[model samples]
Target: MNAIFGWSVLALVFLDELLAVAAFGVWGWDRDPRWLLVWLLPIAAMTVWFLLASPKAPYGGPVVRPLAKVVVFGLASLALWDAGHEGWAVALLVFSVVVNGLALLPSIRVLVEEG
Candidate 1:
């Protein structure tokens, strides 16, 4: 991959995580000191995401990759919508799909050929 393209993919991944945090943070914006729930969502999601879908997943399997991507991105959209940011949710949904598709094209291609 081109260096620029690779950087953009990394940027998108970072942005996705930030958006997830923001989505939940919005809900805990003015809540009581029990704001712990707000932070936990992203932490849990990122943990699962990194383990299952990271480029360097501790375990390897074709099935886990795409499935994890969908699940994580879907959770993000839900979080945004739940927090009353329907616009950002929809935008993230679209952006995640596009960027993820492009970023994982090589892996996807291999899977397609094997299947």
Candidate 2:
């Protein structure tokens, strides 16, 4: 059951990240197709994410991981908000802080502990 719950949480987080990337892409595409950034921004975000925030990424030392998460997810929320998705942005923020917090907090480590 613990394993199931843990994987479920991970799946949700993965989907959330994908949604964030898409949100950024949509925002960029809306602003100006002529600007190369419309495509590059989301690509850049994904690259930075894989490099710095993936579970096994070499750069994600414990100290750096949380900060990287904030940068990645925070940028996603901002992208949604700037794209006129204030509700989605707020929901994402709450999920990141609360859901992720539930998984990360040592006293409530259900989503991360071994089954």
Candidate 3:
């Protein structure tokens, strides 16, 4: 049970990360400099995730890592909302929170922490 739950949470985490990046892309699509931003925003988000939020991030300490995750997710959610994707924004926020919360559970923490 623990193994299944752990893996499930991890999957959700991955999905959330992708969704965040996609949200930025979606928002950028509706912007003035569509061509530039469409490519730039997702790339920027990916860079930030790799540097600060990824499990294997070099600068991701106990505090900074989680903080960076929150900020990134928050920005993504807001970007969606501002882009007239209010439903998607709320869904991403709620789903991200739930998955992150589940990842912190004692039983599943080990699996996620290993990332």
Alpha-carbon TM-score of each model against the true structure: 0.75, 0.80, 0.94
Model 2 pairs whose backbones collide: none
Ranked by lDDT, top first: 3, 2, 1
* Lowest lDDT 10-residue stretch of candidate 3: 106-115
Which runs in model 3 stand beyond 4 Å of their true positions?
Answer: none
lDDT of 2 by residue, 1-115 (tens): 3666667677777777787687678678768752776778889888877878766667876878778888888988988899899999999888877666656745434544443
Instruction: Please give, for residues 1-115, the per-residue lDDT of candidate 1 as tens digits.
Output: 4656666676776687667656656655534554776677667877877788776677536899778878888877887787788998899889888877776667544433453
lDDT (CA) per prediction: 0.71, 0.75, 0.90
lDDT-best of 1 and 3: 3
lDDT of 3 at 39: 82
Report the CA-based lDDT of candidate 1 relative to the real structure.
0.71
Q: lDDT by residue for model 3 over 1-115, one digit each (tens)?
A: 5698789888989999999999999999999799999889999999999999887898888898899999999999999999998999999999999998887788887776665
TM-score quality measure for candidate 1: 0.75
- Misplaced by over 4 Å in model 2 are 105-115
Q: What is the lDDT of residue 90 in candidate 2?
A: 90
